[model samples]
Every structure is written in C-alpha cells, then in structure tokens.
Target: FEFIHPEFHEIVRRRLQTIIESRIVLPPVEQRLLRRDGSVVDVEVLALPFETEGGVTLQVTARDITQRRIAEAEREALEAALRQSQKLEAVGTLAGGIAHDFNNILSAIVGNTRLLLEDLSEAHPGWRSVKEIRSATHRARDLVKRLMAFSRQQESQRSAIPLAPLITEVQHMLRATIPAGIELTVRVPPDTPTILADATQIHQVLLNLCTNAWQAMPTNTGRIEISVTTLSEEAARAQSGTPLHGASHYVCIEVRDNGAGMSSETLEHIYEPFFTTKQPGEGSGLGLPVVHGIVQTHKGAIAVTSRPGEGTSFFVYLPACEAPPASFESAQRAVMRGTEQHVLYIDDEEPLVFLVQRTLERAGYRCTGEMNTARAIEIVRQAPDSFDLVITDLNMPGMSGLDVARELLMIRRDLPVVITTGYVRAPDVAAARDLGVRDVILKPDTIDELAMIVQKNLTGNR
Candidate 1:
C-alpha cells in the first residue's frame, strides 16, 4: 500500500466532503486508510445513520480488503497487457502482408530501371533520370526491409563485421539528417573485435538510435556522440541492470545525447509498443521496439538511461567474434559476358521475367522466359540438355521456385539452378541450399548481378 500512495490525507478529505454534501445514506465504498505506523491500506466502509436526542449520528464499519484489491489490480494489469499484445500482433501481420506485395512491386520497378540503365550510356540524356529512379527504388526497398524486420519476416544475413568502418559509414549518412547545430561524434577503436551480425540490421539499429536522439532534442541544437568499445565480462555486467549471462566477449556501442531527458514515468514505459511522447504524425513509437527486436535477433542486449533536463544514453551490446572483419568494397566490375549458352528463367511476375530476359540477352546469352511453372518443367523434361542453367523466382503460385528447381534437377541431375526472390527467410535459404541450389539472388538485383550469376553457373564456377 505504501508503494501505491504514501499519503492519504487529501484523499480522505475529498471522500468525506462528497459524502457530507449529499447527506444521504450510501452503500459500501472503497477507501484508503492510514494505519498507526503510517502505512496505507485499502478498506471497504459501510456507514449507518440513527437519530439521537438532538441530532443525527452516523456509525461506520471498516473492512480490510487490501488483498482483494491487490488481486483485482493485478488481474486488470494482466488484461491490459493481453490486449496490447493482441493489438501489436495484428499490426505485425498486416505490415508483413503489405511488405510482401510491396516488395514484389518494387522488384519490378528496380529490375526495369536497371535494364534501362544497361542500354543507355552515361552520355545519354536520360541516364541521370534513370539513375535517380533506381536510387529512389533502392531507398523504397530499404524501407520495405525495415517493415519486414519489424514484422519478423525478413531474413538477416549475418557475418563478421568491423564496428569502426560500419559506424563511419552510418555517421556520414546521418550528417545529412541531423541539423547543422547538432555536433555528432563517433569514436571506434581500430582494434575493436568484429561481431557476427547482420550488417544492414546493425545499420538500422544505429540509425534508429541516432534518429531518436535527434528527435529528443526538439530544438535540433544539441550534441550527440557515438562510441564503440570492447568490454570485459566485469565491465559489461556492470553496465547492464539485467543479468548478463554466458558471454565472455562483448562489443558495446553507445549513443549519448545532451538533450531534454525523459521523466521517470516516461522511462518506465519507453519500450512499450505504441507509447510515444511525440505529437501526432511525429512518431509511430515503433523505433525503440524495432531496435530491441533487431538486437535480440543478433543475440545482443540494449539498455537506456535518462533524467529530466539531463540527457539520454542508449547502450547496445553484441557478442564479439575473434575472426577478422569482412571488408566491403564498391567498384565497377567488368560486365560479365556470356557465350551463346542457353538459359531458362521462370517467374510468375511477367514484368520481372521480361526484364531479366532482355538483360541476359544483352549479355550475349540465349534466354527463354516462362511465366508458368508447369510449362517450364515440360520444357526441361522434353529436352534435359536444352538449357545450360535454370533461374527461377522462389515465391510463385502453385509451384515455388524450389519445386521447379527440384523437377529440373530430376530431369538432369547435374543441372545448376539459382533462386531469385523479393523476400527471403533463413529457413527458405537453407532448404534451397539442401536442394543443391547454386545460388540465391535477392530481387531488384542489378543486371550485372544477374549476368554474373548466370555466367558463373554456366561456366561451372558455383
């Protein structure tokens, strides 16, 4: 009861005032009573009135009901939590469905745009516009990926990633989003060990944290700092309020901001879904929750601290790996040239199939496109050696790309096949690999990527 409310004088005065003003007999009512030692307890009161010699007298009976009240409160809390869980589950289902359809649409746009860029030289008048379109579609694809992530439908490709370079890349991108007045700093030691995690998901986690820090400073005039450090078991355990278990090495990424901090009440519910401090249209309150999900998926933990008028700091800790970080490079490679090799491409999406055919043909390959899986299987069955390679979309009506690949492999056991998909799941990839799939290509792949895969598989370089 002390935890509920330490003082009850005002509450008692208010109830007495209401009862006196009515001057009518009332049934039992719930009230708070302060015991002799100053602890508060819940009580049920029944007041009885009788006529005296000169005035009316009232007698009251107080029944202690603290246990019952506590039980009721707990039941109500559980009910509220259940309701919130159901609501969020529904939202996730809707978002995932929308993302699947949206990704397919984006794939078509991305594929066609890349094909257009292939035919038009840099000196062409429409080159810049086409490039811009492709860039926009890439951004759209990223947004879809985030939605899939929040819905727990997107596949994460985990690898050994260096923190310094990844943080540097994100820092450069964030400079444009934050205001000029805000000072942003990043400090990642070169010797920091690599972590096995999804690079894109890590990028999302970092970006979302920084974005929240930016929003926390409504004036857009504050300092934000991002730092990475390797933590020993003792140091890591000290940093988290929750128990740290079974991890010897951890990499800590800290984002600190000197802005308006959160109140105690606000901090308590910060990670609750749909709980937001921003005005309407300013935030969806899903940012922190998404960050939480991503970190957990990577076998990591996150913690936050804040005080009103002070600042806020978010700490993310991921298990570290001894392996050297993988290097990321972007350079123009020679376009893969294919011999007059016959390739069979199957996709339910006609636009994507047509775009892929045009792109492959330009790369000097003889290509055939099939929108129907049964027809594609017939072609493969009729002439097992007709096509040198098979490329099929993973998701389709009636027969999946994996099913087609299997049927094709049955006709010609050594036939190489690639799986293309707009959406991917870890289990799906594992299953495809088990089926002897040579490679899996994510949708909206550049013409260069398609050509390279086709050439590589045809040349027996899987």
Candidate 2:
C-alpha cells in the first residue's frame, strides 16, 4: 500500500477492498508503482479473492506496462506527424495552383502597365492613377510570392548571405508592423559566418518569428531580442535535441521574446497546420508550420522552448558557409535596345504573348508572337534561322517549355532559347539547362529586366 504511487493509492485500496468484501475477482486496474530507487513504473493491478484456511485473503498481481505505454505513445506521435505532413502537402498543391494562375494574370497586368507608363508623360491627367494601379499590382505580387514560399513551390535563389545586414533589414521592416509598446533589440557579432540560403526566404523566416513573438505578448509590452551566433555541430545538437548531419559549423539565429509563454501541450501542436491558440480573426495558424518547412528545405533545423509565463525562444540553425557575402547592384533603369533582332515568342496566354510582342517591339526588336505550340514548333522547324531568339512559356497545353526548347534547339543548334515561367521547379530548371537552354526567367519581369536578358542572350554573353 505504501509502495504504490500517491495518485493511485486510493484506486488500489478500493479495488482490494471490493474484492475482499465480495469474495470474488475484480477487473484489473492500471496504476503506477514507486520502486525503491524512487523511479516510477506503470503496472496493471489485478486482485483475486482466494479461498484459504482463514476467512478470505486478497492476492494482488501487477505486471509492468511501462514499456508498452512508451511504445503506444511513440506510435501515436508518429501517426500525428504523418497526418500533419499529408495536410501540408495538400495545402501546398492548392497554393501552387492558385499562385500559378494568379501570376499569369499579374504578368499581363504588369507588362501592360510598364508599357503604358513609358508611353505616357508624368504630367498626363491619368498618369498618377496608372502609377497607383501599378503600385497595387506590386503589392499583390508580393502576396503571391509569400504564397509561393508557404507552398514551397518557389525555386530558391540561394547565395552567401551575411546575417548582420539581413537581420538589420528585417528589424527595420518589423518596426513598422509591431506596436510602439514592444521594445526590439538586436545583437549580432560582426564575425558571424555567412549562410548559403535564399535571402528572401530567410527574411520571411525572421519576419514570421518576430511577428509571432510580439503577438504572444499579452500586454503588448515586452522585449524582443534578435541575435546571431556561431555554433559547432555538437552544441547545435544539444540545443536543438536533434542531430546535425553533414555540417560541422552552423549559424544560429535566435529570436527571443519576454512575453506570455506557452505550455508544453501548446508547443506540441505548434507545427500542425491550422492549429492556433489565438482568437479566430487573429491568426491562420500557418506561420510556424511555414517556418518549419522553410528550415527543412534549407537543410537546416529549428528548435523552440517555452514555459507558461517564462518566455519563448526560437533557434534557427543553418549550416554555415565560408563563402563571402553576395553583393547586390541595382538594375539599370534604361531598357537595353535591340538592333532589329527578330524574336519568336510562344505562350498559351494570348494576352501575355500580345504584351510581350508589343513590349519587345517598343524596345527596337522585331517580335513574332504565337499562341499554339505545335505551330510555333513548325515555324521554327520550317525556317530555323528566321528568328534569332526563341522565348517560350513553360507550362503549355500541348507541350512543356523544356520540350519546346529541346525541339527548337535540335532544329537550330545555334538559336538562343530562353524559357520563361510563372512557377518553376528545380528539376525543370536543371532539365532546361541540360537541353542547352540559354536562360530561364521568371514571368512578369519588368520591361528593363526583360530587355536586358534578351540583349544578354542575343549577344552570346555567357
């Protein structure tokens, strides 16, 4: 009786008393037992009434069930993780489809607006209105970009990024969104190593983390700290409670908030999709899951810790690289003019094709636009040398952009083939390059960017 766990003492006592009074066997009751060493063990207790020389005696049996319980718990956790993964995959597919269609529409609008702005003088009556329209489209484009990031559909353009500047940029952006009550601080050592990652995605990661931190504060008044440091593989493993594979050193970005923290139960479901503790209108519950996905995609890891009223800290560990930080040069404002180079453009979207045709023509290039892939291929096949460059949309009804590039390149080995897409996968980019593609450009590029690419390819600049 004294050896039983305190919580289960009454249960064991009552079961034995019932068996003694009724002089019959009772159903088994599961409870816990404390060993001599003060360790707890789960046991199934069954009491049996035995007929002895005396009145009635109760015989108790307890089989250890600790291992069984542990196994069941582990299985349940794995099953939950699997379900969450499937849900994310479904959401990603839906988001990618929506982004693709929306980007196509945005491409046409952006292309036409750029052309209009160039043709109209700033003093015109509707110039400001058109400019505002263009600004709205830019915002819409950014929203779609976030959707792509969440869906994991955007091809990451990775380079060596210095954390100091990236965090500073994110700090400035967060200041505008968070309330005045929250105090934000940043501590980054100048010697922090650079990480090979997509700058935009990492930016998004920091933004999401800080946003979550501020919202977790109950009084809307707390200190949020952003810090960067280097960690060895072993130290990272200890901090994250997970092994770090392949990389010896890691760049750790820590976001800490002194706010109303979370319970262990809340932390368990934090990465599950659509699981939010916030009020209905406050959150969609996709932030942490998106952060988890991005970290995994970058070959990195993220760990978090929180306790009720204590605070929360998220540690993002990305493999450190020794490469120098990437440099950014502003794109030239002036559009590169072509010297009457005949260009063949193909896309299923008629409006996009039309806009590209006019835009290219305005930039001193003779352009031919086609909506049918078969006809375009036939034209290229019939007279391969007629067009100096070939630009085709990636996802067409009859054929894909890679196929178009392959067919055209086979016809004219020297012809420059550029593939453009609204949504491109890494595999497709690799396949396109393997097929001798000159370049792959994302859709809805500014007129100057398009002209520059066109000029670069035509001039045979590798």
Best by TM-score: 2
Give the alpha carbon lDDT tens digit for every residue of 1-462 in model 2.
778999987777777777788787777888889999999999998877878999887777889998999999989857765776788789888887776678789888887888888889999998999899887886677666666766677787788888887788789879998999999999999888899898778889999999999999888899999988899989988888877877889988999999999999999999987678999668767789878988998889999989999899999999998888754224335546888999999999888888888989888999999999999999988988789999998888889889889889889888999998877677888999899998887666533267877888898985
Residue 68, model 2: Cα distance from true site in angstroms: 2.1
- Report lDDT (CA) for all predictions: 0.80, 0.84
lDDT of 1 at 279: 88
lDDT by residue for model 1 (291-366), tens: 8888887778899989988999999999888877654213225545788899998988787778778878877899
Give the C-alpha miss distance for residue 430 in model 2, angstroms.
1.3
Q: Give the deviation of candidate 1 from the true structure as CA RMSD.
A: 5.6
User: Where in model 1 is the C-alpha error above 4 Å?
Assistant: 1-27, 46-61, 120-125, 159-196, 215-221, 227-252, 261-293, 296-308, 317-336, 409-414, 430-440, 446-448, 456-462
Candidate 2, which segments miss by more than 4 Å at Cα? Answer: 17-27, 36-39, 158-197, 225-257, 260-330, 446-448
Worst 10 residues of 1 by lDDT: 326-335
